[model samples]
Target: MITPRFSCSQNEESVVVKIYCPSVRASDIEINVDDTLFTVHINPYYLRLNFSQSLLEDDESSAQYDPSSGYLTVTLTKAEKGQVFKDLDLLSKLLAPRLTEPPPGNPIIEVLDSDDAADIQTDEDALVQATESLTLEQNEILEAAESDWQLKQEVPEPLSSLRTSPTDRYGFLDSYSGYFTHVEHTENEVNELGSEAETLPKSDRRKHRIEHEEKKWDEEYYLADYADGEHIQELLCWRHPHLQLPDVSYTPEEELAMLNLPRKEYLASPLQTRQLYLTLLTLLFAYAYESRTTQHDPTPESGWTLGILIPAFSALDPPPYTDKSTNDPSTFSIEEVISTFVASYRRSLAFPLYRSFALAESCRSDVASFLSKGRRMVLRCLLEMKYILDHHDVYYVYSKIWIDDFCVWIQANASDETLHQLGSLICSLKIPKADIGWDLEELEALVSNSEVGREADSDDESEDEVERMLPTPL
Candidate 1:
């Protein structure tokens, strides 16, 4: 049977298998389930998976096909809950190659040209002698042998997998982990084997060799925390292209570009207020993109977080509360703003706390202490999610509760300048009136009790000082 292009993921109780077979149909599909065994057949291709030793419960399996997506999902109930499967796509294991041993013999070897044959006179004499005596078949064989050696050389076979031990099986994670490890290495290559390694014991040297080889294999791969902007464009912004900010592909640049204001030419014909909100959307996701556990570190490729790049709070404040001045909604609500934050937070975090921590710790040598630390920070970020849903409430939370604690919390992990930018960014976001409306009077009242309101109205000389004191992540 032909191989199937498929992927598998799991929840607490079931394994979901998604097979990509765009040309297949429900009429051609077949599934057989037994208590520990599962089988899926689509015409000429079929998969038989025995999960007796796995977490699978082996009963009440189910399948569904989405014709539009051309994918079939099969759900297999799990015997055990909360047990993580290191792998679920066992097709590769079942399909381990059955290699036939080569016949025992010393294979014939090709010889280099004899010194006498290299000479024109000797070669001409030999050719003439062969033409005079040998049959056409014999001459053809000789001529073919002579010509084969002179043709373009064949490429040598690639080296085998870099896996050094049985436990070090190869997979996508292995490749990506190796890349992150390579990027972290900053020592002089010469020095690694020079005076420093010379002093180490034999065991240390062997370990070093293993690490070097692993890095060699993974140096070509890079894993990202989120899918591209194109992934969700249809879901969120089919018509609103400006709202669909593209996820960053690999590059020499940091995430600051995503958060920064769009250039003048990039903003099409839109009201000033709309431009302000759209630019705010860019900053929100940009902040989310950079929130990865490793992004705070200063690397050669992407240096320190460029917090000081954002305009100061005073500069971002909308012109003195006016409905006539700007076509921005008269009433602003915070529901959409909070929803956006929640969505972005989830996108940035990518996985549940437990799952994320597990992935981080696993990817760490294969990402290690650095990645582990990053996940811990992510845990803290999860706590910040609760207070970020509504504007009026966010302003109050920031002014009263969060400013006092969350500001310091972020400062511990990021630069002081970054903390200020985050504060400004949250304050800068204003959800335009969609359905329900609140006027400037209500907007002022929503923030009136908070320090953000005070700082927004402060004199330029005192603005800087007051802005520093306005810590309301509460």
Candidate 2:
């Protein structure tokens, strides 16, 4: 299988999406396009891609596969000129076509039909509306690139506030940021409250404020946690080459040990287990990429059929209950063990992705294609769940949960023979890239002042709010 590598760009007239398939000639590829879907296939491999068609206009769309450059170029004329493509990474959100439901905010950005819009109230009104519409479209692009929900949740400019990095900027701050400004209120202010507040200690009065400061991920933790040989190190490092971590070859013996760990032990060593989940999940993703675009050759030494590699754990079956007696020795079963693994994995990684999904859900989604396989109910449940994330910025989080959950469920019910197929599927994913290059707004207040004491000047503070840009999650 070959992963389809691609890039996209757009102009006022058209949007161009290019699939980077090296050495692939015109005859070696197959392309399919419809009103709202884009599917690609390359011969008899497990290589395929289906994109949400909801993004495109039904006008003259063209696809050109060039053998010389190995780039599959698809040109979609914008339904409305100047309408921005909000999400070019449509493949990342791929899982299955969701049910006929609303996207996040459940608000359809009602784009008016050109023919029906002939009734212009006034030329000036039309121009103003058009300009506003264009601005809204640009905003949608920014929203897709940098999540508004995350923007509100994360410190607006943690890195810009830092006076240090390798570049002497984006240095470390409090892990749970915005920890200061804990000055005590006057006694009258405290006493203005009810007796519960009156009786409370001045220290305890700050509990709510203190709780807000306790954040999960920190710059230091990220620097320490996501490194070579760390769990899911391959996924993170490969995706974010900007991080410059050395290559990690996750071997079979190590993978087996992860799967074989007792439930209690697995739960106890969350880091090891988390790395295991992350590793497996990322490998699954990498396999998808490699299987579609390029790198279809497997090493003879490794016995892999394709370039993508599967874990030994993916191939092995959990041991059946051997110590069965009048009283079973273990309280947990193999099913429970696998479920727990999936649950903890979702807590941090999947949960974050689900937040995005939830937001998307509020807006209506495209009518799901008949080809999509996942259940509609499950997606809704995922969207509705309270999204408490550990690492908000890590990409490939959703696929890890969904793919891992799908495989784990199958593996639990499946026989050892089917394990080979599961393993093969895992090896078909392609390497993914990280979303860096985030817009960093300089926080003059936090950037210059380490301690939160003096109040920011009203005029200067007002300017800072406008200058504030979202940070890359730690």
Candidate 3:
């Protein structure tokens, strides 16, 4: 079955989907609308979409086909009139299904009642009670300390609240709770650590380290290391030549056509999923690097680059992993996940940091090299994936299948030697002078002069001190 090309537009009361199916019979077209889902079937051409808001097949809803134009126009009424609909133009999101479960380890709140008497209590009442109780407690503490003008000391608890035993053995909930106990750290660093990190698996610790390192590089670092060079030639050689070539920018009509292209999800194995994510990281980094080097600026949105990377509309081509027995009509594919990684990164809070020099440097060689090395090297790419995954998006399924499994497998099977080799390899990687974009000789001379000046000042201070000590007799 062929999934037809389509486009969506919405007003306050209705959404219009225009599907392109050439030489189709109008009477043969069958349509189904169930709450948020909409499906269309006409012999060989099929299209399925899941909308954010529910749709109603009321009098306002209608379907029409223009045989000459090869367009099937289906109008869907909004469940609530005047309610605004969003993402009508984001066709990939519309094609993907909504998440069925909360992410692992999150609390699931069950709303048992909407209008019960217990639900009527306001926040102001709770705040007033809390304030009164705090005041009484403070009064008592002041009275006790009044005699000596100092509070009495008490014995420390045997264990910290943070160090209390975890409720689960998987350690996803409290993986890092015991980190400080076994390892020494400054009080402030320990205090700065947030509770949320402990809820994630231990494999994410490397991601946190990568984030921390990137934070240390500011505008000065970017200017010093990446912005000052003649980078276009290097970028062209480093990435694809096609990236440097100018192509006609997509018009609104063309963009809508690309957005609505028919696609399908692949039944990928765990190994294939891992390979897919690794490839995604490589592509995203290459895109970011190419943008920075050629454009001399970070790309705010990366979805447009997909056209240059892949042949136009080839993303919707039938994938190799299609299963005939369990095939579903939803238009999705591995390419869509790749596209989602780029789109999700744009939506992330850390999008601005997408082109950090540290990230590019890490991916410089390892992007392709890490693929053959299996889980250990793939973990490095996962650090990149961590930034792009954001909170929730299409890649969440891959996360559940591959990322979570890798985390568990690594926790059980990873040895100290593997970690040592990873660290050693990271340290061995050298940054070329051209890559740094800094004049090494000039920077070194400036540093040397500054140090010499500091030494002379120190000598003068010592001479003055000696003079002051001897001159008192005169």
Candidate 4:
């Protein structure tokens, strides 16, 4: 009888074995030793033995042949004292009996009706418990989600809070507690540092250094005495003669002649003119504040001495004429005249300091009446300054000084008519236009319809109108 014959073949990466027998059909199998043993448990399984060992004596390198699925294999590379064919034959014989007999202690399935019922009951209870727990967890998660949504909607929290907020529904309290603890620890550290801070005296090195630096700056930048209008007038009187006042008995013609001195002779000095302007402005402010009558003697110490100088100087040194003539010689526009005067004044002085004094004076209560009267001559001077600044793109600086002073006066005694006139004047600038429509109207209405100014019609006038139009009873 031809017993089953086994043979082995080798590939580059794996080994293959063939099993043949008179009773069994030929079968081919392949395996690798590095592969899991569980992989060889398949039907018609094969073993892969290392072929690097020499076949000489029995050693640890020689492994026993065991085929999990009725197949046998022996590696020629790992054979010891046996030929490849003999090793295969030995492996086949060793595995044949093991394959023919049933495996020992095979798993048995027992049917225990009573015990199965109990286990089923237990499993059902566990499932129900798990479901209940899951439902509770889901409800908790939903409630937490709603609460978080509400919090986000109600409060504007920082992004940092959002980043540190717990994402896991169950871990919210723990995360919040940890965050608070961390904050407390940080606060404690800050408090400890604050408590330990030293109370340094002014004599301390750092304090001394700061004090020294402040003292150095104070000494370096000491402010000089401000030159007042009176001082400037004195300086002018000392420097120029035509600017000097003759005896009060002089007639108006004599005074006018003195004022009309040639510009090249008496008004040649720009500095004297600026000083005179400042003195005139100061006097105007004093007179306005005192509410003095305009009809006062021109040569009074407190009257024309300061106020007449400006007009006299202007007459002596008239501004250079421009090609643009006044629209109406009899009643020149106040806005145009003021603009011309300011522009001429600025050009003549070549400095903003003196210009600011002139503007401030014009906005004062006394001279403010002049602006209020809408006089073409005075208004021309003010508008001239404004025009120069607007044309040169320096209106920001000019407006800062002019508008602030003007607003102060306006606030004290502003009228609807004044606001309307102001709006019209500002609108004429064309550049950097002012938004005066609603604002001006509102300011005007506030003053015009005030409760204190409102009054009921007289009884006699009311009766006379009533008799004129008696309505027939309906």
How do the predictions measure up, each by TM-score? 0.22, 0.24, 0.35, 0.17
> Regarding TM-score, does 1 or 3 come out ahead?
3
Report the lDDT tens digits of candidate 2 across residue range 357-420.
Answer: 1111111111011002122222221121101111122212222333333333222222223233
RMSD of 4: 45.8
What lDDT score is found at residue 5 in candidate 2? 51
Best of the two (2, 4) by lDDT: 2
How well does candidate 4 match the true structure in TM-score terms?
Answer: 0.17
Give the CA lDDT, 0 to 100, for residue 452 in model 4: 32
Error of 1 at 379 (Å): 23
Q: List residue ranges in candidate 2 displaced over 4 A.
A: 23-25, 44-60, 94-474
Off by over 4 Å in 4: 1-308, 313-321, 330-336, 343-368, 371-474
Candidate 1 residue lDDT tens string, 1-474: 754566667787787777766778788888775645667889766765544335343556677888899888888777777666532432332222222365766888887766664587878988798788988977777788888846446899999645453232111111111211231244322122333321333344435533433343221121211112233232222222111334212121211211111111121123433324322332333223323323333222111111111111101111112223323332223453333333223222222111121222122111112212332232232222212211231122211221222222221222223333333444544433222121323433454455465666676758778888998786
Between candidates 1 and 4, the lDDT winner: 1
Q: Write the per-residue lDDT of candidate 3 for residues 20-127, one digit (tens) a residue.
A: 998989999999999999999998998888887899988889999999999999999999988877655445556655546545676889999687655457666786
Cα shift from native, residue 190, model 4 (Å): 73
Error of 3 at 391 (Å): 31
Off by over 4 Å in 3: 101-285, 295-474
Best by lDDT: 3
